[model samples]
Target: MSGIYIHIPFCKQACHYCDFHFSTSLKKKDQLVFALAKELQLRKDEFKDTTIETIYFGGGTPSVLSTNELQYLIDSVYLNYKVTDHPEITLEANPDDLIINNIDALSISEVQSLYKTKFEELKKTGINRLSIGVQSFHEKDLKLMNRAHNAIEAKRCLETATQYFDNISLDLIYGIPNSTNQEWLENIQTALSFGIPHISSYALTVEPKTALASFIKKGIIDNVDDDLAHDQFHILIDQLNQAGFEHYELSNFAKKGYYSKNNSAYWLGKSYLGIGPSAHSFNGKQRAWNVKNNTIYIKKINQDQLPLEIEILTKNDKYNEFIMTGLRTIWGVSLTEVKKQFGESFLEYLLQQANQYINNQMLCIVDNRLKTTQKGKFLSDGIASDLFKLR
Candidate 1:
C-alpha cells in the first residue's frame, strides 16, 4: 500500500525553535491550495497501481484550513488516485485552532471566497484522524516555547477532539531548558493519562536561523545540552515502556495495533507522494522534494511545472539509507534481506564492520538479525554513519 502527504504551509505564528516550512502570513493561502490541487493532478501517475492506505495533512497547521478547503483537496486525491476504503486520514492541528466554540470568527468564510465556507464543519469532511500539537502541559514551558495555547487550552482541546474522533495522537516536546528529569517524567505520565492511542514526541533541537538559536547566541536563552537530552531520553523510554507502549520508531510510541501506519511506511521505504512546498516524495529508486520557498512554489506550479528536484539513488546510496533508517526502530536490520537485496560482496562488507560492534557488546545477533544493544540506541546515528557504504 502507498501513502500521500500534503503539507499546508501556513501558521498563525512561528514557534521559537521551529524550522519547518510555514508562513506567519496567509496572503497566498488560497492560491497555494489551488496550486496543490493542480500538483496532485499532475503527479497522479507517480502512484499508479498502488492503493493509498494513508493520507496525512501535515504542516504549518492543517487545521487552519476550512472544512470545504480540506474536502476540496481530499476530493482531488480520490478522483485521481486509487485509495483504500478506510484509509487513515490525519491532520496536524494546533490546540488553539481546535476549541469548538471559537471557530465562528476563525472560519474559512473569512476568505469570502467566490463561494462561502465554514471551518467548523470539518468533522463532516471525512477527515478521520487528528494529530494535535500539545507541546507541553505546563504553562511555564508553554511561555518559554511561545506556543499559541496555554496549558489549560492544550488539555481542553484534547478533551474536545475526543468527542468527535477516536484516532488521536498528541505531539510533545521534551528536553526543554530548565526542565528537570522529574518534570519530564511527569510530562510523560500526563500524556499517558489522556489515554490517547498514539504519540510522536521529540527531543528539542536548536536549528539554525530559529529564534532559539539567536537567543542562545545572545546569552538570553540557555542552549540545550546533549547530555541532558540523552538522560531525559532514557527517562522517556523507560516511562513509556512501563506504560505498555511500543517504541516503534526512534521518537514515536504507540499502544498495541496503534502505531502510525504512515510513518511506518516511510521508514520501510514504501513509495509515496507528497504535495505542497517543502514536501518530499520517494519511489524506491528516486526521491524528489518540492521547493521550500512558498512564492516560488506557487509561481512554478501556476506555470504547469512542478518545483521539485529529483535524485536517482545509486547502490551505495541505497545501502547507506537502509542502515540509517533500519537501526533506529525496534526492528533490527536483517542479514538475509541485505544479502538478497545488496549482493554478497556488500553483505560481506557489512559483517566485517559489524563484527567489532558485536564483540564490544554494542550490538547483538538474534535470529540472524543485527540489532542494537541498550548502549547503542543513543549513539545510533553515529553507528549507522560508520556502517555506510561509500561509492
Candidate 2:
C-alpha cells in the first residue's frame, strides 16, 4: 500500500542537533498550508492507481500547528487522494506542544490532565497515531540538547498520550556527549515505563552545519562518543528485546501489530508522495525532492510548477537501495529478488560479497534471504556498504 507524507515545515524553535528544513517565522504559515493543499491536488495523479493506506504528518514540528490546521490538511488529502477506509494517519510532534508549560519543575504535573482535551480533539480530527519526540527523560540532557520541553514534559505527555492512543511511537536519542551508559539505560527504562508500543531511537549524529556541529568545531561542545554509542546501541537492543519488542529495523522496535506503517512502506520501497519544502518522493523508478527554500517552493507551486529535482534510478541504483533497505529490516535481502530483477551476474556479486559476513556470523542465508546477525545489527550500515555494487 502507498502513503502520503506532508512535511509541515515550521517550528516554534530550532533544536541544536536538527538539520531538517523549517522556518521559525510563521509569517507565511497560512499561505504554506494552502500551497500544501494545492500540491496534493497537483500530485494526486502521480499515484492515481494506488490506494493510500497511510498519511504521515512529519515536520519541523507538526504540533506547532493548531488541531484545526492539521484537520484541514487531512481533509485536503481525503479530497485529493484515493485513501483507504481506515488509513493510519500519524502526527509527529514534540512533547512541549502536547503538555502544559514547565511540567518538569513541579513535583506533580497537571500537564497530563490537560492532555485529555488535546488528545480528544486530535482523535476527532482522524489522527490515529502519535510519534512523540521524547529525546530524553533527564532534565540536564534536555537542556544540553536545547529541547523546548524538559524531562517531566516528556514523561507527562506519554502518560496521557497512552491513555488516548494505543498506536503510539516515541523517538529517543542516544550518544549525546557525557550521557553515561547508566543514564542511557535510565532513559530506556523511563521510555518503557510509559508503555509506548513502538520506539524509534537513533545515535546522536553531528550533521554538518548544524548547531551541534558548529558547537563542536568551536570547542563549545564535545564530539559524540562512538564507542559509548556502540555500547548503548547493544544495550538498547537487549533491553527492548527482553521487553518483548521486535527489533524490526535498525533504529526501530515495536510490539506485535504496532510497527509504523508509513516507515514500513518506505523501507519496502513502496511508492509515496512527499509534499512540502525539502521533502523527497519515490515511485520505484524515479525520485523527486522539493526545493529546500520555502519562498522558492511557494512561488513555484503558485505558478503551477513543481520546484523540485528528479533523478531516474538506474539498475545499479535500485539494486543498491534494495540491498541497503533490505539489510536493515528483518526481511533481509532476497537472492530470488536479485536474480529476478538484476540478473545472475549481480546475484553472484551479492552472494560473493555476503560470503565473508556470513562466514563471520555477521550475516547468514536463511531461506535464501541474506539476513544480519545480532553482532552485525549495530554495524549493518557498514556491512551493507561493503556489499554495495560499484557502478
RMSD of each: 4.2, 2.1
lDDT of 1 by residue, 1-391 (tens): 9999999999998899999999989999999999999999999987888899999999989988877799999999999999899998888999888764444466465433311222236556778788899988988888888898988888877765776677889998888998888888888888888788888888899999999999999998888988888898888889888989888878888889888889888888788899999999988899999999999999999999999999999999988888788887778788898999999998899888888888888778788888888777877778888888996
lDDT of 2 by residue, 220-274 (tens): 8889999999999999999999999999999999999999999999889999999
In terms of TM-score, which candidate is strongest?
2
Evaluated against the true structure, the overall lDDT of model 1 is 0.86
Cα error, candidate 2, residue 27 (Å): 1.5
Pairs clashing in candidate 1? Answer: none
Top candidate on lDDT is 2
Clash totals, every prediction: 0, 0
Off by over 4 Å in 2: 102-114
**Cα-based RMSD of candidate 2:** 2.1
Would you list the C-alpha lDDT of every candidate in the order shown? 0.86, 0.91
Query: Could you tell me every candidate's TM-score relative to the true structure?
Result: 0.93, 0.96
TM-score between model 1 and native: 0.93
